[model samples]
Target chain A: MLYRARDLISITSFGEAYHNKPYLDRGDAESTAEPVCSTACDGASKTQARNRYPLRLERLIGRITELSGPAALEASCGLLREVQRRRGVPFVWILAHRLPPFAPDLAANGIDPQSIPFVFAPQPVAAAQAAERCLRSRAFELVLLDLTNQATGTNRGGGDRAAAAQRIDDAALGRLLRLCRQERAALLALTDRHGDLAGSLVFTRFAAARRKGSGRSGARERGGSDSCESGESSADYEYRVTLAKSKTGRPGAVYREVLRGPHGML
Target chain B: MAHTACCNLFEFALQVLLRRVPDWEAHPCVALAHDTPQARVLGCNAAAAELGVQPGMRYAAVLEFAPQVYAAGVSQAELHQHQQRVIAGLYALTDEVLCKPGDPGVLWANAAGFALLQGSPRAWAQQLSMRIERLGFRSRIVLGFTRFGSYLVSAAAQTPAVELLQSVEDERRKVAEVPLHAVVTSRQSRRRLARLGIRTAGALVQLPRSELRSRFGADVELVHRQALGECELPAQHAAVPVQPVASRRPPQPLISSEQILLETQLLLEALVQCLPRGECIAALTLQLSLDDRGQRRERIVPANPTEQVAVLLRLLRLRLERAVIDQPVSALRIEAELCRAAVQQHQLFRETVPERSGKQAVEAFAALRASLGEEAVRYVQLVPHHLPERRVQWRQGAGSQELSPRGSVQAQYADCPGTAQMVRRAFISPQPLARHLLRSGKLIGPYLLSCDWWQSPSRRLYYYYVMSPASDESTSALWVYYDLDRRRWMLQGTV
Candidate 1:
């Protein structure tokens, strides 16, 4: 029954500022037609729904994981723009070992490379240090850690290489999470997919989910079947974002969107 | 009678000569020689004097006497230039200043009716001494009723300043006590006087006038007359016009880093104090002489025009830290150039700009470059390109332009509607993978992407979206791409 209700809310809230509007407007008779036994009961249910699918824009202090591909890049850029719009003067810092060459595509999609500050670290340790220092200063509002190169260890041996790579990734993620919590700065860690899948693992301090399972919570877009109607379309790519950890909203929440552009822009 | 004050700077040639050879001063056995092919020793400091080096000895002969002695030759041109600087500096104290052509170290000024402008003759003499000192010369001042008497008193005074002789009787008493060498021009006559047991002026006066005249000629007679205050010598005022003079002194040789840093700080402070009102130092040039006689020069321009001593010192410290000094520094010279103070607009009520902190950050970065080497500090520069990786470049050192904007992304992309927000994780190199199956979900693939046809043939790629088999959850997705030309499936990145 709860799953059915959650599906209804997710479908109706797409591209709408439903979370921003007041849950119950006293003058609106349409709100009263929802068969409310009591005003307190209706208010409680409304609050519960809001908490289950917190607006992505309002989740300022959280991480966004880009499941690796061109589609992930496009989605991150779009999310960055959204954050910038909502915060007004949000200073975003992109910390990476090396920046990809698709900056022009980002510029074409209205994400200016010149507008974002990039801190390049030659190694993973350096990137971690830079991110920690940048966040501690609170000089930047959003810090994106490009772990794509860092998470993949050099293939020196057969079994040890994979284990070592996983260890590096886990350590980097743990350190970044600690820094984000201490500074209360939003940190997103991006890594490439090892298989034929792409998705985001978001770690946020705002919404702490009570559920324990790893099931998809809300708003899942199926595939990269979306058509490219306008702008420069390079390829059709789809991405899914999962709220892996949150301090204020549902932790296991997920959202999916398809991007179509020369560089995977929506 | 009008009183004349004479100011004599001791070792003027040696001081000015030391500026060119910084390490020579540290050698106890060092002498200045005239710049002739023969190179006759003009003056020897106490160190050389102790080693039997005497004035007028041939440079080669002095080396024979003390092979360890360091001999530096002073050109006539350089000596004359230094002499003119000293005269011009003293000229500022009085208009009626007389500086003899041969005696470049001494200056005679007519203090007659100008006592009120200078407080008193003694005060005027002290002021003149300070002015000469500012020109990097050590000076002694003497005041008397006659030019020769003043000269005698200045030459007799071992200390930097001598008492003023208010009357002719006082001048006569002081002159009688003066050594004969102080009044006599000829070294031969002074040596003759010493041989005859007449070392003091009083003893010279006691000798029979006919005998003195017969022994030393007319010059001895005039010297005796001047010593007795019987002959009055007029001051020969300088004919040349006075020009603005700048003082430059080579700092004492400092071997320790602490001493070097301290001396640099003092120099910076002095430079700041010398700056004109409403002006600050724009650039500084530091010239250092090494022990091996090699020279090292460094020029530093602050990120912001600053008169603050601490800021300048900090930058210098950084520079010194990174500088590789092969030998101990023997001398240092600091020169500062002035510029109009930087003017910044201030918001009336609220803070609109972080100009002060921004400037400090730039200065800090400069210091970092100095301490950590030039490659330590880096800044990002964006290049216009279609390739995502080639579009950004990191360069060492801060550029003049402002740091890239931080919050303008939204306005920049506002025109592009329905743009999917995404972040791409780039791979160092795309990892090759084999075609695999997914347990949690079916594979979603073959999305093709190809570009850059001009440089190379257009390479085709087939991308697929599948769930990781190790993870049971259907939510986890991975992106895989197939390179057609390479004929291989590669894990491009994770979504």
Candidate 2:
């Protein structure tokens, strides 16, 4: 069934709208349908689906992935390092009024700054439109948006403080999400620790906050030679990446990582 | 046979430049090859011509003579964009169109079918004129049976806004009467041909064809052939849009949605099999026949154009799943709009260097630039500069460059013993900092960065430290600098 016909039938059993009216599928019906039947399935299988979401991050294609925190750049880059390794995926970084992050730092990380393209959309509406055009092309696999700091436009004291949050309106967001899913392209938006991008449509939502009492500089742990060697690495700060909300994976789970460099993020 | 309508816009580049300012006639104006003063002039208005400014003179030299001259560069790309808009609008007016390749402003539309569909050719030509005028172009529309005939009539400077040719003889007579100074005629060629006692097109056409090329040039010969009706419209280039529509009337009504999907698959497969190589269906329109003989139409546009039946069928299935099927579907018609979906060169197995050859990606960047200005899209370019801001330059991206970096990228901690190196934000322009913010914590460094002493000298004393926040446990890393020349504290950037 395309929609949750059973739930609608059960909820309004007494009403004519339920029995007499023809069934029309809701857009988000499939996502909501799982919880009702979750009790019937084994916990292990449910966990498998939950844990599989992050494990498949490198190979998995689309969805709105939100990562915000002090070390969000590093965390998001760590995930992207694998995707770029696939070689030909086009990547674009979008900026809103503010200058992009330090390029040498981005080069220090595995990411080649020259390889990525940047879009300078000063206003919220323009940024969203630019992003929409990029996504609609169905060519870009990974699009990173800098919705971190408050954009300081021509006006001094403040610009639109909610510029980042209001970047993509609800209607635009809905369209972007659909385009992402259709293209199987990931739209990873990186925000600061105080970002207002904690929306429900986020396929994977998490944050990496720097733990207090920084760890001492220590020898590095290598998953392989794939780690960025150009960056002078030091285990100075430990970040606790907490999953606040995840439509694909289990929420509320915490993972710890020893960040190399303050944030040698992609 | 489709009757051709030729619309000519003379001095298109100059007119496009004039469109920018309303009272352009008040001043001497000229369009250049580029916006720079050194760029050569492309076209000029009457006032500029009166001031001794010619098409090939440098804009700076023109300014030397006429100091109050106004100038702007109408780039070929921009002109082509406007031409595309006109072509697209003409497509809306009529199906078949052949835009003159080099001459972006000149368009030939097949108005044969449209005369009946749109009531009359005069009204349609008026609409066409209004449409081009709205875009700030003065177009002369001439309707005739042949492309060369209509074009010749339209190119004549003294022709009316819209003229309808009654017959082929009338068109030839008008073409013969066209002066040597018609907008389409090359100025130098006109001068040379006039010296040979050929002041009109008829006099030029009377010359022997064997010696036409030897006497004049190949261009004149080509024009002579066109006038003689020897040259026809390039058949291969004539893009007559053919919409593929498939209709299926079932023996019985389909109650199950699955049945409809199964039928849709068959129809899509048939269409895909017939699709030409390198072409994909851009969009699909599904017309569901109701039991009462009414139609419910649903249109679907995929993220990317595809010829694959499965991808299109999946979208249709999704639509059908959500559709309100109040009555059984008795019949169906599927119309597909096709578009070119060719991908550029791809790497089969080589991953040696990062490359972006995706045609769609190129289109993506183009779409961005078309909506936003040229500076809207940018690419990061690393440069060897002492100042942090100068180290990286954000330049406009052409969307066709290689991603491989051959330049040396600076690494602060090239070989540090620490496993983690901190990241810092570099501001394009430093923000002013207060003395109180630095008082809360000990500064890490007085890193001396002074350079360009030979030029407009710049000296800076930089420091790095962590500042404790008043509200939270999260500490903020600050990078402040002291301008030795100004003797003031400024926040360079932050971590």
Candidate 3:
């Protein structure tokens, strides 16, 4: 009961800015905050619902953000579209030379593949530099610096750590953070789900991973909700994003988002 | 961390003549690098240019086109003197400036933090132009973000006065329109590009960097990179131009490659010690007296000026490996040009204050495009095709607009009502699909994907490869397919 009271208190403060309002006051969302709160509700398995609001990424604006996990790119793509479409801010995506994210999929996910610009850096250092250049040019309102070793064949522990160090150092992050604050733009650095690679001055760091059963190796969830598609494996997979660290104080808070329909929610 | 401006006193020698005669400005005149008929035209006045007298055209050839064109020659020493004076005038406005050696008349100045001191970046540029104009030479100043971008803008601008390009797209579009001949120094390379029908900077960029360099020359490859705007600029540290000479006379004549490398290392180590208080060695001119077998000379320039001995040593080792050190018993001399200047003098002019444009983020960066070539920065577009791979097409850099066809769907916000989903890790090329089938039993596939869906024997059975030995479904899985034509398995992406 005390835990439930704490959740009520949190819901009051975190949702204070909204007070059951639509994102950016777009006037499309329901006045009742039930739409967004339905999906990622804490301590209530019964709260899982058939519909929910778009994942809220406005919380990370003007921040030096890091997102990692199995579905990190998906979460980031959603954030980019949200900022780009709703807020009307231009953004640039810097990718590794080898890791070419499927553009059709990105377009399906609400991004105007034509509207966003991509910079290909071979290493983390180059990605950081390109991000810096875009920030300085004042053309982009958001910068996505993907330092994940998607191109590198090695996904083991040691290599990721070494690559992270080489790609993202304190000096580079310091400079990027200052620019984000000064320009009031968002900088998102993505990495593999594993490894503690968050650097200093990151205002918010989170991981968007698929929520599994109970343990390291547990069975898939038995029951399903209405929004989930037909068939066992074909249904939209639900992903849980947990805050790893934050300058905003909530370290363990989580949010949930679901995949689009098979034909991209058309 | 502000904008940079390029101050080009076009045709220094011609400008000098016009200033001295005051009447030459109205007449057709050309500044000859040499007075000989065979010598090329270094600079030409508007009147001369109007009469088809072009820079780099032979004076003898110009005689046929414009016989009345006046010719004058300025010595190298005099040109250097004027360049130094103009650089000096520029320093009065900004603290840092850069210019290539032997390539006088054009210089880049740091144009940041002037909104308070002067006004906008445009005003700072105006003051710079006025200061140079006060020196009696007409010039054009373009203020923009990168050193190369700004210089290109100033050189190619149609308007005569100062032009300010503030956005990245504007600078890229303007740079793309510059003709190949204006930037490329070699006439042979320019002709080679012209023969390929690649007239503009944008067209040259479409050609691969390595092929362009191999076929045309190193100069042509450089212009191609610049047009893309992804190229990392070299270090901008030049002041009080100091060339420190350090030499070594081996006690005995050596006959081995090892001895030469050892001797060179010692010389470089010694050179490192004597570099000025706050300057790094920019370039090293290594002259070896090869036992009266003539002198073997090589000038080694680091990507950026550095005081670190290791970085300098690595560059030296690379140069030595390629160099033939067959001859022995010689003296070695190394001349190092100063990379950066002592900041004490600059500090005196202005207070050390934090910049408003944010940390070094606004600082120009030699990014991925610098090493990976112009295609380094690219965007993807989905084309309607049966083959999954063929559906994706790549477009490079910030092209002014999309290359979509007529009646193609415009990508708009209103169309996409749902949030964006995860993107698979797509490989530019497919990798081998191995070890997944043998390990995990939870395979979902045989969707029967095919490049040519109508009727093609080259068919594929696609699958979501669950790498985990456990039966639980993972968030992200590898995307693999078995090809019927190749009779093998290949990994395409992650699902």
Candidate 4:
């Protein structure tokens, strides 16, 4: 029973475009027909089948496991990292064109930055690690991309500045999109409300009842003193989330998660 | 080194010097020896006659007849130098100079441009002859408007002309009475003629054209033309192209990377100049020398002749950079020859279009790999997993085409986990079945394979799975199988 009931969660019209398409549902059908399913089950036990909608994480993981190689997983890592950052992170309006400081931090949380893996690496060590592990060992659970700083480090004034700008622009975003489209890894890219993630499924954050100073929720607790700056309150930063892109999941549904986190995030 | 009077006479001189002269280089003359004691003189019978000495005359008889006669040896090097100097002088008159080493110095100069610079063509010949005489060499010079007439006149006259052909009138006069030997009579033909009482150029010229051709073949027709000075010579020039010039200044008197690069650059530049405009290079030759005592190694690189200097430089750089310096090239010289031009035909619509997808894929892979690591990208291929401890896989790159025409590989599992299980629970060889396996109790498996005959053979086996449930380690699946036909047990793989 590869068919899933199209009820349960309220799928926005936009979300239906991502998962309700015939092609999107066909992936599940293909997975069911794999010869490995018979070998894995040993064809001995009878199990009850359940109807599900919009596909589940388990099914997506299976597909990802089947499609992903080192390169694909590396791309997924970039997407997932973006998603994590978009959930909740501090915003410092710094124009410095260099890799952001929290990239390693995000990667440490199991968000791969590359399709493969490498032990002794410099920048994007997490990407290398993911690539090596995924490509060589054929093992990848998920991939996250954090593009909050994708635009940084590209404004170096030099020859053919426009061409350089365009190339960099495409690389920062286009590579991520292509990776997700081709790889089996489930990509989750996150970005702020105003920041453009190029190709990603956007979601909104909820307005919390717990005030910033009161620190009622865990997100508020994380937002410590000195979190507010320049007379503008944390509430002033509107958290707008919308699904920009989704291959196997909902896209338009505005699933709101609060921006407030421990130690301060906007 | 034997001296000679003319390039045309070089062969005659060589044959005479090598056979007749005992120490041709040292003596530079042949010593005349006879039964009677006679003063040795170097001249042949004809020369002896000029000195009032007959062939059979004793040396005393020659002295009595011509007491002032001077006997001198022939210097081959002097003759060679004289020929070269004549050639050089002729080149000063025009740019087209063709001198086949052993051939008579038959030069063709285009007087169309240099007629005024060199004075009248007749004067030029006289001046050329005088110059040769001043060099202590003898020469003859003749000129006409046509090459055939000039050749005939020069052969009939005493020497070659500075300008072989100058005008129509001069050509007509010189060509009217050419000697038969100038046009026909080779050694064998001459001997045959002699047997038939035919002697002298005038006599052969007198023979009827049809009868001469019938009896003597093409030689008769050649003689007839030469006699009438009607044979046409292709218009050519006389110019001694500068001797190919190459020099090397090596650091530490040995080859170095910098030196190699510089030398290649210089050679390429030199070749660019050597090749005519619009002409491309067909081939290039590079010769390297180790040192004063080093051996010379020559390398020939075939390339399209191109007027584009940059292309030549690039090619040279590539060749030099890849050159293996077996011995330090203390000296190097490069020469290039012209080749035919290339003609390109384009399709209707295809232009200079770049391959976008392929380029992007590779660059993206490279960039990601460089920024990330080598393991950043991976390929997926199908392989066999025989046992619990063993797993085999293939590598398929992102750009690799799926369904590689190679049939899908299938791993067959046995029906029952018996002794066959033990055999299956072992390492499966990816390589061909080199050897067979057996067990203590019963026949288990046989490793069978068929593959690339050149590389190795592919293998197919009936594999079985044996599991150890209680081990602290993960359940190790062992692939065991039996060669049903061979009645043999073979352990193929373990996972």
Model 1 reproduces a share of the real contacts of 0.20
Candidate 2 local Cα displacement, residue A42, angstroms:
34
lDDT over C-alpha atoms for residue A240 of model 1: 37
> Per-residue lDDT tens digits of candidate 3, residues A135-201?
7755566788777765223333466466656656778788888888777777887877544344667
Per-model CA lDDT versus the true structure: 0.56, 0.66, 0.64, 0.37
Q: Please, what is the TM-score per model?
A: 0.39, 0.44, 0.44, 0.26
Tens-digit per-residue lDDT, B35-121, candidate 3: 689988888877888899888889999999689988877555456556667876777787888885556877888776753488577
Q: Give the worst 10-residue stretch by lDDT in candidate 3 chain B.
A: B357-366
Better of 1 and 4 by TM-score: 1
- In candidate 2, clashing pairs total 9
Top candidate when judged by lDDT against the true structure: 2
Docking class of 1: incorrect
Tens digits of per-residue lDDT, candidate 4, A97-212, equal 12222222222223322222112222232332333223221222234332222211122235445323422143433443344345433433222223232223222111111111
Candidate 3 docking band? incorrect
| Cα RMSD of predicted structure 3 | 22.5
After superposing candidate 3, which stretches have Cα over 4 Å from the reference?
Answer: A1-36, A39-58, A86-88, A150-161, A164-167, A211-233, A261-266, B1-368, B398-416, B419-422, B435-438, B453-457, B469-473
Across A1-266, the per-residue lDDT of candidate 1 in tens digits comes to: 99999978875875354332333333236334332121112246654453332324446564433334323454465556555455333444444444343444555556655545455554445555556655554445566665454222222234645434433355555666666666556765554443211222344422111111212111122111224233342333334344544544554444333343233321
Q: Please write out the lDDT profile of model 2 over residues A1-266, one tens digit for every residue.
A: 63688866666775643322211111235323332111111233543343222423553356776777766665565554445555667767777656567777766655567767778776656676677778877667777776666222212344356444455667776777888888767777777654455456667777767643234222323212233453342235544456777665576665444445543221
> Model 4: runs farther than 4 Å from truth?
A1-266, B1-89, B98-104, B126-138, B158-180, B191-206, B233-243, B246-261, B264-495
